[model samples]
Target: MQRDKFLKEIENLNHPNETLVPTHCSYCAMQCGMNLRVNTSTNKIIGVEPRYDWPVTLGKMCPKGVTAYQQTNHEDRLLKPLIRDDASLKGTKEGFREATWDEAYDLIVKRFKELQQNYGKDSLSVYGGVSMTNEKCYLTGKFARVALQTRYIDYNGRFCMASAAGGINRSLGVDRGSTLPWTDIHETDCLFLAGSNTAECHPTSMFRIWAVQERGGYLIIADPRETPIARRADVHLDLRPGTDLALANGILHLLIENGHVDEEFVKNHTNGFEETKQVVKEFTPEYTSQITGVAPEKIIRAAELYGKAPNAIVLFARGIEQQVKGVDNVSAYINMALVTGNIGRPKAGVGTITGQGNGQGGREHGQKADALPGYRKIANPQHVKEIAEVWGIKPEEMPEAGVSAYEMFGLMEQKTIRSLYLLCSNPVVSAPNSNYVRKMLKQLDFMVCVDFFLSESAEYADVVLPTTTWAEDEGTTTNVEGRVIKINRAQKPLGESKPDWQIQVELAERLGRGKYFSHLKTSKDIFDELRRASKGGNADYYGVTWEKIEKQNGVFWPCKSEDDPGTPHMFLDKKFYHPDGKAKIFALPYTPPAEEPDEEYPLRLTTGRVVYHYLSGNQTRRIQFLKDMSPEPFVEVHPDTAQKYNISHEEKVRLFTRRGEVIYKVKITEAIRKDTVFVPYHWDFERAANILTNPALDPISRMPEFKACAAEIEKIEVKKVQ
Candidate 1:
């Protein structure tokens, strides 16, 4: 009866004048299923309705997903290409003038040729983002290496998913965000989430988390802040910022001492356990408490709960992965799942809370500086030969690997890279040390940006090309579970805006690289090429046709042939991805942050996302509803810290670091640590938390320590009127 009533209510939601087009949301990796309501006569996106048939999210939608359709016809949408003639107004919105596509293309081609001719091919760089479809990301790599012949190409994922990717690949020999399907989450006996704020970041997955606890399963959380999920956890290991490595090592030590080790499994299917065991031997609960600031009793409870469960899953996000030893932290947590024999089966494994819409697939295809299609390494001769054959070029024609995303700014400052082609990202607001990043961006000789709106970063562009929104394009994206899903077109392109794929193809034609890209006339054409390019590689997508995706709801990767079903649960036969078919257990030592708290800067400052905004607040902040909900950023201060600084709630305070400073309204609460302060990094300019963030990169992942830095807060004195 309940099922029938739910079906009836869903049927009642249909409108007579609107057509419901099935698609996915444009925000985070949850990729919540939604049906866009399109006006029948006008063919414009009107609103959105829940897609109850999709299995991953069911009918669930977060606030961002609910209002995603509003972005299609937003008033701030860029309707034409812009050209900035006045160099003095580079960082402001006052210098751009409307221009034709031909004018923009001519200017971009001329400038690009002059730079390459004078300063060599490596002078050009392409900085991209993962929010785009897999097709665009794949093409972006080919365009930079084959069309422009430049080696400096990197994406925004370096700052977001690189640490998780680095750790998972090193241990398991393959990088899939999740080892098990999302449907198995609720059936697990225990969930140990580290450094992730799931309630705000990936809210659609909360139902499954809550269902686990409701079924008498345990939930443990590790974070500096007492987040909403932490408040309800069986054990909240409120560790200090940048100390996740110590906390994870302590739990692993306890798990092993308590006889939770699966001796038979480790002896047969794993290597390096003895070495790892020796490294964590000194990380006792008492020793860990001294470093992480969490009680030893809480650490014991967390280990016991996880070790006693019959089936368990370990999950994490940027909080732990944004530190100087982020890769080490990830591997330490993965050690827990491996030691407990909780993986390679249903209701058990490890997963990452992917932050972007296509974070999984975007990294797989090629946007990273060192990668190729199918996660192939550019330095490998065999990998280069395979991709060269696919692109109809010689293996030697492929350029060597370049630096990471943040390092590209250093190259720009040194005049090594004089031009840039940026898309789908707003680095001026997102990158650490915003003041320095802005200065480097200004130093570039020429820059072109492709986006739907004039983002804070786009204001400095010489040419800004208008691009269509997700509702106006058709492509595929890999969700958080490593499931390959389709994004359908709900409406036609608005105004003169085009899709990023179309823009790139057209630009390639103008740059005399027509033969390589002109063959791809549509998104499906690009996908066909992508399938062939990814053949026989790690992230094989050869068998995942659009028809197959529609039939299977969504397909997991490594589907090699048309008859082959996708891999839903990885390592099902207890066979790992290493050459010897065995997973690795790494022995990583705990390392503190590059910039620890000092006497002068006595507080630890951490930054993260809020429930009301997405990365950089480029699109979400433009929406009326979301903007009203979170108009600006604020600093979260503990009561004791506020009292120590003589600050009060809602009062403005200046938060500073060695890099820069920003004044934010104080929000006093007991949810945060007394020695730490928290700020959201969604706003831009003076309010951006990146202004105070440290740019110390992890040696392995190249991920900056955006979560922890030395900071100090001061109360601003008010002046009395004379």
Candidate 2:
């Protein structure tokens, strides 16, 4: 097999002595490929060169990807371990002292052992991040159960992908974000994007959407705010916040009533269409208009466009998923796909616009609270047995799933889970009702955070260990299209930092669970184990190998063997993953947001991300260019709403909700709805939008409602110069 063509072309840019390393971005699920311009003399990564030949992104780097390498040399990069003093640990005053690696490790192991001995194994917990490589995520889950013998483990992916995952699994047989490759967008007649600011959040991915639009394909955007994507939409339905269910139901009703559905395909390939007909019958355009704030005519037009299109794909993201009825919101979208017979085919299906870097694969592995590797359910006895056998442990030795990420923190408040091992995630700023989450974290008996930067979440940890970022690590990351691509190490670990998997392996050895972890000598070793563990599971990787990745661009999952080329698009045979090989449809009804506007709280608050920063501003905040682009968090207020509150452009406004309150500088614009205010949730404690967000969870998915809450804005009084 020949080497990748991009590698050879990049040789000219790098010095004769220096190396150019290939790796996927650690930002969004798009996973744009880039090569680190390394200086062999200094052993430093000076810059990033786009890897144009990568299959998913085609070398297009978002703002986040271009500046992501700067974090390695960030001034605030955590270079040493810090052990909080007794006073700081007790919340008396802020204090932490630098300590040797051995000292920090001994303290962590000792405290963990004491907690394990006194409060039982379930008392220890771990919280992972989706940004981590597949190897690190797998090892994190393994360490939590095998090393500590604890059933309390979860990850930040719960908050990001739980709703999408649950919806996809229930409606279809499986839950890979995209049923078709990104290139399929060009072949579609239309692209229905709801609840996703595709142009800003996934800048590189927008090229695919643009390709469709350029070819006379229609664009339908449904969102509360007029994002960049919405401005250019063929039909932009500026729906009210948290009303995705109603809008989707209305669309389904219109499609079915207009006879735009493929009746023959529905009868042959799907079940539950009759039930959906009955449920959507009541969601007429007139009724749904009252709830969703979209005009009756606009809703009908959107339905007509999406329904009439011969080939189209519907995509949604956090705006739809981060709500109290997130699962139903997703179900509603899928229902439309079913009646329209848009699934299990080329250029037609439901896809989730996953936000996190590995949002799709991150949830597939056992890092989640209620899953084993390969996207297998923890409740399934056969799945438990299979994974247990692969792990070299008795099925009985394995415990049931623990509480989710949010539930784990709540357990801490109840004095149940006393120890928390947080790696690669910063829940203090990312979690809904974060003010309370911070308090719950402080109540933990022991807390250890592993990260290269001293993030807001790590500031409260009892011990903080500097861990290497993606630039200094070698592993595999699954992209939005379900392609697993190998990421090579570009530079050595800076200072005393270590890769996250190495830290977990070393910590496990210290915990006396060394024998089971001995086989994991490298990221590849762990990857091979993941392949064996996932052989017959949902996200089968047994067919993929590192050597194979070098030969091909990247391999998609369900690859049966080394000779297999791997499937870029799934369900081409029109067969679902269900027992009867048929897709299931939901007859979901509309439900209003958990918290709606009222006399006391007359404005709806919606939170999202800006183009420049990633989640929680953990790494992006350190990048000078990104920080310069977006200096601080600001609220987007409609001119009508701002006028009522007596707030002007760039003036500070106090936005209050039932959960909490904060004062953010307001940017008055007509881009937002008069009934709602929008804020980016990337700031710290003083201005974090999550502080005022509700923690109401979707019963099925357990995802928090971060998008909609009863909120009111008031102008902040200016102080005199005196």
Candidate 3:
């Protein structure tokens, strides 16, 4: 029965397999839809044209989206599977050699079986990425437990949105980004951005940002650097690194003292209001100014602007999330929004600026340490029974939740997990304390990586299997607003690469677990079962169908049945999903970063992204145009700090942290605070920012503090040319 179902679905598959296939960009969470101009005769991606009718961006796209098609035909794309060359026979002593798909699959199954028998099932681990489609993520987690039967599994979204998820789950009873539709941003009367430089990171979202200004709304930006987006704000509170929680407390304190809080909403729809009010009483603007580097007047001014606005939003990104106090930082922002009665309405709430392609959908459909498909809990017996039934397995067949992303690597150092399987991520470059992470990778008994290119992390693997790219596959990804949209295939797979789903299914077939996975053929086939698995869960998609997504631009989730219209705005009835139908207002206190500045390491080093590249620069850096725009790594130093260190603009300098140091060319600017230095975290190998970042994680979120670490600078004397 299962084999027949798989064959039928594969025979009736739908995706980017032909000319003019409609798909979305695979870069950011925006997921702007575009049509691939393909030449079916030669099965080549010719060009890209905007799908202007889609409401998300109105057909507008960033530079990356326009040039994304070039990657399909790029010369450097992997044409075949590559197995690590043995010491006896090889062109390069320690590199890979071309191999057939069968050879790659044989190596994977043989090594994994040997390791599982010797070190036990727990020795094999799986680490996935947020860029994968919802079906792929769910299948990866299931494959790990059902096929490998290992308890270790997680994804890269842990580094992107785990803190926000933790904060929202505890306070609001749910964790979907921007509970309202994407159009709500246009209706907001005031918007505050913390740690996010949206103008550069998500350029397509500018339509909503400008809409607020066009309607005379106020904008406030809080960051150590005055980025291009901050320049547009009415008030820019350039706070010191690791001071986000302090600044949020100060804003709320001012709002409460000025009688700006919505007392009615506090009394009826929330818990812990009195406690939060008591805590913010001591966070005056002056005290906040001493902690954060912002002036007292600016804090008060920004608070007043937001407090007076009828509709407001509090937006944050990795700047606030990638920290030791990440959850506390996010809870503070949510506290302010709830206190002002800014959410549960048209355009007032908290929204996370997701960084990865399917970060939203990835987290919603399992792949996290403690989560199951449809955001179900691993410990919840009812959720387990329902999902187990869908997969034709018993409730006990599912494994328990494992450690988080960073903790998984820590286990590798202990040799607990001997085999490693990575999908769609380059953790060797992106994980905190990457030098330590690489050492952990070297400790693995066997490693396999599935990706379109030989990424930095993949370069260390025993077997590298090629997978289909965005231009040649079809799947559905939920955008930042929780809208599920379909991406159609534009052309046939290049060379011998297959879709990620096919790879997992075939691997399962080879491992003697074919019965459970035989039904998953096409993405839609997997989605059909996913709908049944997700039924009655928070991220329910029972009513959504491939037919609906193709007919409409996209549909929002929690659409319970076919007759039910999609939910565009969450909590429209002003009731949260908490047990008592009321949201909780947390009274989180301000705390300093795990590592602080001292006399020896006198400056704070913070890392971030650039307009020309995305995370770790595995894909964007390969593109010639993007590389040309932002070539090489440089540190942004304040003019005053440069003088103190005897450094000049465009001169060689060394930034030293307790962990390590890297040489970078200095670019002096007044836009940054004198005590803080900003370095883009895109480049890898010798130029990666994670090389100097602290791995101290949030107790609740387990997110590393990549935003703030203590460091100092020294001028590297450059010799003149003869």
lDDT of 2 by residue, 1-722 (tens): 12564466456464766777788788898889898888788888877889988867788898899888888877887888888987345332257889998999999999999987898989888999889888888888888888888888889988888999888888778888878777687679989998999988999987888888898989999999999989989999999999999899899999999999888878888888898889889889899999899999999999999989998899889999999899888878888887888877788877888888888878887898889899887899999999899888898988788888898878898899998899989898999999899898887888899999878888778998999988888988888888888888888888889998888888888989888897789999999998888889988888999988888878888787889989887888878888888888788877788888999999889999999999999889888779989999989998887778787899888888988889988899999999988999998887898999998989988899999999988777888998
Root mean square deviation (Cα) for candidate 1: 3.1
**Cα lDDT tens digits for candidate 1, 1-722:** 74786575466467576788999999899999999988888888877889999998899999899889989999999999999999788888989999999999999999999999999999999999999999999999999998899999999999899999999998888999999999999999999999999999999999999999999999999999999999999999999999999898899999889999999889888898999999999999999999999999999999999999999999999999998898988888888888888889999999999999999999998889999999999989999999999998899999999999999999999999999999999999999998999998887899999999999999989999999999999999999999999999999999999999999999999999889999999999999999999998899999999999999999999899999879999998989899998888888788888888999999999999988899999999999889989998999999999999999999999999999999999999999999999999999888999989999999888999999999999999999999
User: Which residue pairs show collisions in model 2?
Assistant: none
Candidate 2, 80: how far from true, in Å?
2.2
Clashes of each: 0, 0, 5
Query: Which runs of model 1 end up more than 4 angstroms from their true locations?
Result: 1-15
Model 3 earns a TM-score of: 0.96
What is the lDDT ranking, best to worst? 1, 3, 2
Candidate 3 lDDT at 485 equals: 85
Candidate 3 lDDT over 24-98, as tens digits, reads 998899998787777666788866779877888889888888888888878878889999865222212267889
TM match of model 2 to true structure? 0.97
Cα lDDT computed for each candidate against the true fold: 0.93, 0.87, 0.87
Predicted model with the maximum TM-score: 1
Q: Which stretches of candidate 3 lie over 4 Å from their true place?
A: 1-19, 87-94, 719-722
